[model samples]
Target: MDARSRLSRAIGTPVLFCRHANRLYHRRLGLRRCNAGGVDPFDADWDNLLVLDACRYDMFERRADLPGRLERRESRASTTVEFLRANVDGRDLADTVYVTANPQLHQHRESIEARFAAVVDVWRDDGWSDEHGTVLPETVTERALRAAEEHPNKRLVVHYMQPHYPFVGADADFDGGDFTDAEADEENVWVQLLQGRLDADRSDIWECYDANLDRALPHVEEAMRELGGKTVVTADHGNMVGERAFPIPFREWGHPRGVYTPELVDVPWLVYEDGPRRAISESTPGERDAAADDVVAERLRDLGYAE
Candidate 1:
C-alpha cells in the first residue's frame, strides 16, 4: 500500500494519522517546549502507611463536616499536609489510595481469592497469623501494631475491609445477629445480585451491609488503640447499594464493575492518635479519650444501645 493508505489503515483514520504525524514532527523540531518545573510528585513522606477497604471518599467528606471540625486539607493542593494531619490526630482521611469496586476487583471467585490473598500476604509478612479467620481490618491493624512495636519510629499501614458484602462472620465482639439458614440464603441472594446473578431489591441488603460496618468498627478501634501510634482509617473501595440503573439482576453480591458511581466510590476517612498530637487543634490526651469514646459510641449505636 502507498504510505498515505498504510498510515490511514494503521491509525484507522487519515485525519488521526496526520494529526499524530504532525505532532511527532513538531516534537522532533523542538516546537513543543518541555516544562520540568512542576511540583515534585515524590515529595511526600512515605514512612507511614494506612489502607482502608470498601471506603468511599465522598462519604468521608460528608461525615468530616458532621461536627464542623477543621478538615484535614483545606486546599486540594495540600495532600501531604493532610497525610500528616491524619497521623497527628489519629483520624482517617480520604487521602489514602482508594480502589474502586470495579467488576475485576471482586466479581468472580478467582478475583476475590486473589484480592484476599494479596491482603493476607501483606498481613502475614507483617507477623499476622493465618490460623484464624480474622477479619481483614483486624488483621491489618494487628500487623500494624506489631510493626510499630518493633520499629517504633517507622510509619505503619492498617487495612480494613468493611461495609463489604457476604457478612459471613461475627464482627469483633458484636453478636453478628442471627445467622440462620434464612440469613444465609439472604446473603447468598445478595451476593448473587452483586455478582450479577438474580434481580432483587438491594435496599434491605444495604441495610444489613451498613450494619456490618457498625459491627466491624469496634474491632477496628481496638486494633487502632493497641497500635498506640498515628492511626489513619480509610477504604480501598466503596459499594453501590442499589443506586443508578444497575439493579441486582443476579444473585451476585459485593461491588461490581462500572459501578464506581458516586454512591460506591465515596468513603469515610478518620484519624486517631494516642500521643504527641501536634497537628490538629485537639490535645493528645483529649483526642485519645475522644477516640475511645467514639469507638464506644459507634459500638453502642450499632447494637441499638444508643440512638
Candidate 2:
C-alpha cells in the first residue's frame, strides 16, 4: 500500500469519524492526494462551477428558483475536506481558478496549491464576516468577478459559504460556546438544534436558512452573468437537519462526513447555459501566499473547527 493509504488506515479516521475526517487529517499531513477517495472535478463538463457549501438537493430543488436545468447527482464525499481532496487534488488545475469563501479550504490551503492552479481565498481578514465568521455571498461575488477577470485563461470555480452555518439571515451567531458539548462544536446548527436553542419547524430558523441561500444565489447569478459560459450551480455536499442516517438510526442534526446517507451526499447539479462557450485565453499556475498561521488557526477556531 502507498504511504497515504497506510497512514490513513493507521489513523483510522475513516472508521472513527468517516472517510471525510480521514481525508481532512490526510490533507493536513501533506500526504499524497487520493483520487480513489472521491470525485474528480474534470469529470464534469463545465466552464464555470459554482459550489454552494452544504447545500442539499431536496432543499435546493424546492428553493432554487433561478434559471437553469436542475438535475440530481451523487456526491463523492459528505464534507468539505473530502470534497476538496476528491475534486481539486490530483487534477490539472493550470487552467482553473478557484474563488471561494469556505474557510475549510483555507484550513487546508497548502493542499489546494499542490492540486489546483489558483485560489482566490476571500475568507480572509478583509472579507471575513465578523457576524458570520464566514465570508458572505456578496464577498464571493466580488472576488469571483475579480478572479474571472484576472484568470481569463482558466475555468472559474466559485465556492460560496452560504446555506452552511452561523445563519446570517437570523441572528444565529456563535460568540461563546454554550452548547450540548457533543463531538460537534458549539457554533454549528447541529449543536444549536440539539441544545433546543434553534427550532427546525419554526419559520424563523428555517426562514433564516432560506434567506441565507437567497442572499448567496444572487451573487452566484451575478458571477454567472458576467463570466458568460457553461456556468453550473452545484454544491460540495448537502446538509442534515434531524435526518436519521440509517444504521446509526439516531437523529442527526448537522452534516457529519462518512455517514453516506442520501441527505448528506445527494446534491443538485443545476446547469446554467449562458450563450455560447467562451474559450479561456491564458493559464496561470496556482500559487500559495504567505499566511499567518495564528490568524488561520483563530479563524478555524471561530468556525467551530479544531485549530
Candidate 3:
C-alpha cells in the first residue's frame, strides 16, 4: 500500500474499511494454508491446467462433481496481477497454449505471448450479457478443446471467468441486480454488497457466488473429459465474503491484491488426471472483449477490478 492508503486504513469508517482497506494493505506476508499451497504452476506435473476465476476451496468442494481428487492449495497472489507476476514472470513457457475468457491475457498480452506459445482469447464483446457481465464458461471450453487439438505438443491453460461476480445460476435464488456497463463503471458488486446497497443478504451474496461457480464448473468437467493427460483444476484466487482481517478485525470483501487471508487466497486444486494433459501458468489481471484496451478495461471494471 502507498503511504496515503495506509493512512486511510487507520482512519476510515467501518464501512470504508470494509470497502477499501483490503486494497490498501495489499501485500502477502507468506502465510500459507497447506504444504503445497504456493507451488509454482509450471513446476507441477500435469498436461492441462483449468483456472476458475475467484473460486473458493469450500465452494468448490461443495459443488465439484467431476472425476478427480480434490484438495486445497494456497494461491501465490490474491489478485490477477499478483498471480501472473508470481507464476509467469521470468519463466520459460514457450510450450504453453493459453485459452482464456479472462481479460488479463489482453491486458498483459505482450508479456504473456513472450512466455507462452499461444493465447486463444474468447472474451468478445459480442458475448456480453448484462446479467452475466463476461463471457460464459462454455465459450472457454469450446476454444480450449480446439486449442488443445491444434497444439497437441504444447501445454494448455484454460481460464474461465465465473463464480466471481455477475452471478448467474439456473436456481436464480439471488438477484445480482444489473451490472450493466454503466453500473459496473460506477461501482462493483462487492462494494455494493459490503455497503448493504444490494438486494440480497450476506449469506445470499455468498450463495450467489457459489451459484456462479455452478454455472461454470460443468464446462470444466467437459474439458477434463475431452483433454488428454493429467488435468488440474485451480483458481487464480478466492473471494472474501465478509471475512475479517487481522490486527484490526475489520471485515473484508472482494479479492484484493496484497491480501494473504485464507478467504482471499485459498483456492481449490482438483486433479482431473483421467488422461487429461498437464502444464503451467499466473501473473495477475482479468476481463473480456475483442482485445480493445478500453473495452478490456471495461470488462475488468465489470468484475470489480480497478486495474
Tell me, by lDDT, which candidate is best: 3
User: What tens-digit string does per-residue lDDT give for candidate 1 at 1-307?
Assistant: 3556755653974433443353344234434321111122112333333444454455355332221122221111111122222232233322322111112122122222221101122322223222322234455555555545544443444545444433433332112323212222333333334344444345545455655566556666675556554555555445545444223222222333223233443444455656552222211111101123454333222222221
* Residue ranges of candidate 3 with Cα displaced over 4 Å: 1-37, 109-114, 125-131, 170-185, 276-290
**Best to worst by TM-score, what's the order?**
3, 2, 1
Superposed model 2: Cα runs more than 4 Å off: 1-39, 110-113, 172-187, 192-204, 281-286
Instruction: Please report, in order, the local distance difference test score of every candidate based on alpha carbons.
Output: 0.36, 0.69, 0.71
Candidate 3 global CA lDDT score = 0.71
1-307, model 2: which lDDT tens digit per residue?
A: 4556755653763232333343355344345333234455557789999999889889888887888899888777777887877776656677777787866776776665445668787877798877656677888889888877777767888888888765665543333442222224635556456445554453445566677687777777788788888988888888767655555355556666455577877788888888778676445574567668788776666555541
Q: Residue 21 CA error for candidate 3 (Å)?
A: 6.4
lDDT-sorted candidate list, best first: 3, 2, 1
User: Local error of candidate 3 at 103, Å?
Assistant: 0.8
Question: Which is the better candidate, 1 or 2, if ranked by lDDT?
Answer: 2
